[model samples]
Target: MIICGTNAGSPRCWMLVNDTVLTDVQGNGQIASASDISPPYPSQKSISLPSDGSLYSAMSSVTGHPGSIRRTFGSQKLLKTENVWLLNPQFAGAAIMPSTLKYKEEIYFFFSELNKTARVDEEPYRARIGRICTVDEGGIKALLADSWTTFMKARVMCGAGNTQQQYNNMKQAVVLTAQDKRAGVLYGLFSNAWGRTVICAYSIEDIDQAFSTSKLKGYSSPFVGSRPGMCVRKNSTTGGHNDIKNLGVIRYHPEIEDVIRPVGVAPLDLPTDDQITHAVADIVLAVNDEHYSVLYLGT
Candidate 1:
């Protein structure tokens, strides 16, 4: 289902379902009815079924705390459901992008790490985007594996032109290209300090693999542009130069040296001789349809 107006609530979340009206059950919950209700929304309400039976509403809570899943389901009657913490709490301050696809029975989460160290000049802390994978199973087994598996410990950092500084304080978003179904590539959009310029990076492996082998050879270059965000479409009936079209939004600075106007996505195989540029916004991928989606918590 399309979830609209998620960023428009008082707390900025979508409230209506299929155009049906819903009443807030409590401060953190909502209830739906066949008809309308008066003020002081019900904390618990029953939903009518086709057979004239009733189904109770399932509530989800999001505290926006570290290691918290923004969405969950809990029984109103039993109160026995447990909350799922997908990431380690140590990475609590990190900006969570969102969730993407689940492959090989693993669910991937993308996020950006903000550099919190104090500086004499007081520059804004920079961010680096990465991905982590956890088991899809919901049980002690999954939680244990997520918490302790060494294989899960692998991570990839965005690189800047063979220098760490290129991606320093980088803000990025990742998405899977539908063009290469056999070996989908993860595309990243990032920016340096001042957000005046942006860069693009790509990896053959999924987010998890990209994070593991970021330092290895064959990674894409840190292409420069204004600010950029990725637009990815899989299986486009609309024909294009490539089976997949990786589009980006970018703005250019006229005064900066080596700064190019209007950026574009060249074929992945094309020579790097001034064919590409950077992006403007964070690229977002669908969690279920794509391999992964990464969310950012801070600006």
Candidate 2:
């Protein structure tokens, strides 16, 4: 699936299925596209935010690609839809990155906003990430009075106060939430000035209480790691951490057809911090023909 947008045009998303591109029945790309391109069951519509046009135009011109395009059913098609909108009302100057994650019945989107000058200076130039809850069937409604009803405000993180470094250019976020059978928590992997780092944040359900007041803690790894992608699964047969197994960083090898693959094992008990920091790259969760999978987005 692909999502694209520009200042002049509406933001859109497309689905690639069986080599053909499929568009939404209504043709709005933002509303009909899947948040996660890979999965047990790929959804038709997911959450999407508007774009500021400057970056999207540049990306479109360089790649010679439209605002949105995807392969599905052996063909390519452009997605156009207007099912979702940002509730914050203050994101007109923001440029959304290409990474997003779905968790806790909501789609969390990450975006970087540039001020009027288009520079990441101290003048309100920084990355801003936010989340919008999924609206039920009848489309989005208006909020109390003047507020837009469909979208919810997102909680943003800046490398300030407690953390040593600031998160200057955060691009993506992958959220792993514990299921009912296991402990409930949210783990996030994001980029900062130093490099990529893994932080354990509160689950999406607790965002209202955790924002600003809460700080995300880092998880120890066994690789020279940054930009970690994570997923959780139940292993009833195994008993520790409620059988909550953590899939470590993806390993890239020359022989592999795909560039990267997940390092499947439990790393919670690894004693030394040196064991962490092995491989550093951005990871994304995607699905193939058979099952759930993960992919490293960076080289």
Candidate 3:
């Protein structure tokens, strides 16, 4: 039961190797072609870790490797492109970047826009997260026909006013990959063009609301005074990219937006002049008969 996880900062491909022929998958021995199927991909692209048979992978783009999702049975195989999910035009948050977590049967990628160019006068980067239900069956002809139908994103208000200028770049993120669902929290590292990073914790519930709720309409004009990416469900029969594009124009979620998030910047003692860099989070389960977990943060 060898499962291989290969990704180049983004995208993934999973393949299972048979028990009898572990010898067939070679390394520096220089076997020109083990078979027609195995040689097309460079061995370097593979992270070489066994898989759990789940469609999840993460890596840094600097590797410059390609990825795919393949399910193999003996000598037969099928390319499960339908299992793939991604964002279009990319979302902002080039400052912080994206992270992944599995909630229920779905997988989530927590990231923001690629480059937070101000659509409005001084608007900055906005934090965002998207999800793909492992169970999504895709669609028919023009629309849901691909493996990426359920993909969607929305704005996140972690810092001050939850506005653009407040937390422009979502610099780094740490997700609780092994905590209890209800007891889990997402710590997003955010910053601005001015060079400051703020880490905010979003509860499992609030994070779910941001992705599950319906989105607001698009902004016709910035002067409309409407904050984009409001998480409200709508009843329109519109199609694809508009669905995610609407995430940018969400009206607002008063109670859930700015008010319910972490109130202040993470209380770190970094020098005021230097911008913060990276973060890692751990969920420590309580000792004794406690029914909860505590997030231990180390700088």
- Pick by lDDT: which candidate is best? 3
Candidate 1 global lDDT: 0.27
**TM-score against truth, every candidate:** 0.37, 0.34, 0.51
The residue-by-residue lDDT of candidate 3 on 58-176, one tens digit each, is: 22112232232222223211112221222121222211112243223444455544333566555344455654444333333443333333444455666555444466456565666
Order of all candidates by lDDT, from best down to worst?
3, 2, 1
- Give Cα-based local distance difference scores for all models: 0.27, 0.28, 0.39
Residue-pair clashes, model 3:
19
Is 1 or 2 the stronger prediction by TM-score? 1
Task: State each model's C-alpha RMSD to the native.
Answer: 17.9, 17.8, 10.3
Off by over 4 Å in 1: 1-18, 23-107, 116-135, 138-160, 172-174, 179-182, 206-299
Model 3 stretches astray by more than 4 angstroms: 1-52, 57-104, 115-124, 162-165, 177-183, 219-275, 285-299
Q: Please give the distance, in angstroms, between residue 275's alpha carbon in candidate 1 and its true position after superposition.
A: 18
Q: At residue 142, what lDDT does model 3 achieve?
A: 48
